[model samples]
Target: MNMEDLTWGQFKALLLAHPNLHLQFKYAEDALVDASYHITEIKKAPITSVDCGGVINNWTEIIIQLWEPQGKMGGDAMKVEKALSIINLVEKALTLDAEANVKIEFGNSTFYTRQMYPSAIAVHGNDLIVDLRPDVTRCKAINRGGSCVTADKGEECCTPVKPKVQLIDLAQTNCCEPGSGCC
Candidate 1:
């Protein structure tokens, strides 16, 4: 609800404080971005239905559309799954929001976690209440101690770059249950 720097710990606190909040997402990319992903060509996304889904009373759905993939991107096959995974990951942030020690720095501009709800969902037009909020996190390389530890309290394995994300979380966050941070 607040737009300011937040440590992972602070973010955890907020989500833990209010675990019932839901999340939604919308992705708008230019024709160029789409074309690049497919490695082919997309004249334009006349009315692109990017990805959609989230907790509707508890279940979340996710879908993605790209121009096309010519070769076998075995990883590409999991595109939809990845989207959902992102949702799940973020929900962890929320459920563990109370336990997160958030810290972020974007090139010279030091910052903290901030909760951002899409403007599209802000409208109380329909009889719909916003169920999710997109959260912002500082990428690992850009922030302090943003490295990935595949196993906690154990030896560090692969350290990956922090994701520059535009992620959404549902109240139950689809992948997370009440009081469970999707861990």
Candidate 2:
């Protein structure tokens, strides 16, 4: 199933139902998280803000942070059942918004720290694969409306204009030169 189709709570419920399945994270086709990484923390962040154009926006996110043990022997990756247990423990302490967006935060010596969303989730054999996708900055005002200035149709708003520049050769004409109007 598409990860984008499922809410954070729905995804957690799915993981809980598949107790025997193993979990694997894929940042890209060739790059994958270490097999020893574990889910260290789950955070609920409620963000409210105004965009560059003064449009107010609000959203919530469930941030799942993953970490690999330091200097440890080879360890098996976290199992789906174990992950469910961790979620259950977290749910008891803090209420999680089921409709909130889900994001996974991960980093290592080779990979820079980033919070990415799951682009896709698939069940292959005994493993449940989560393909993480990076997020990009976007023009929120233009997205929410037609233009940053107004939502009216056929109206041009905030069109970029090239700055006018004048260039003069100092060698041919200078302020210090004769009859150059220097004090």
What's the lDDT for all of these models?
0.30, 0.79
Candidate 2 clashing pairs? Answer: none
**Residue 183 in model 1: lDDT:** 48
lDDT of 2 by residue, 1-183 (tens): 556545787888768777887888888667767778889999999999887665689989999998866653444566899888899999999999999989999988777889998998778778788889987777777886566664544434456546786666667777677776443
Error of 2 at 74 (Å): 4.8
lDDT of 1 at 115: 30
Off by over 4 Å in 1: 25-183
Find the candidate with the highest lDDT and give its number.
Answer: 2
Worst 10 residues of 2 by lDDT: 152-161
State, as a TM-score between 0 and 1, how close model 2 is to the true structure.
0.77
Residue 126 deviation, candidate 1, in Å? 13
TM-scores for candidates 1 onward, in order: 0.18, 0.77
Residues 1-183 of candidate 1 have per-residue lDDT tens digits of: 342334334433343443333321222221111112321111111222321111122211221222333342332122323334443565555343322222211111121223332223232222112222344543332232454333334433334337686555656476555665554
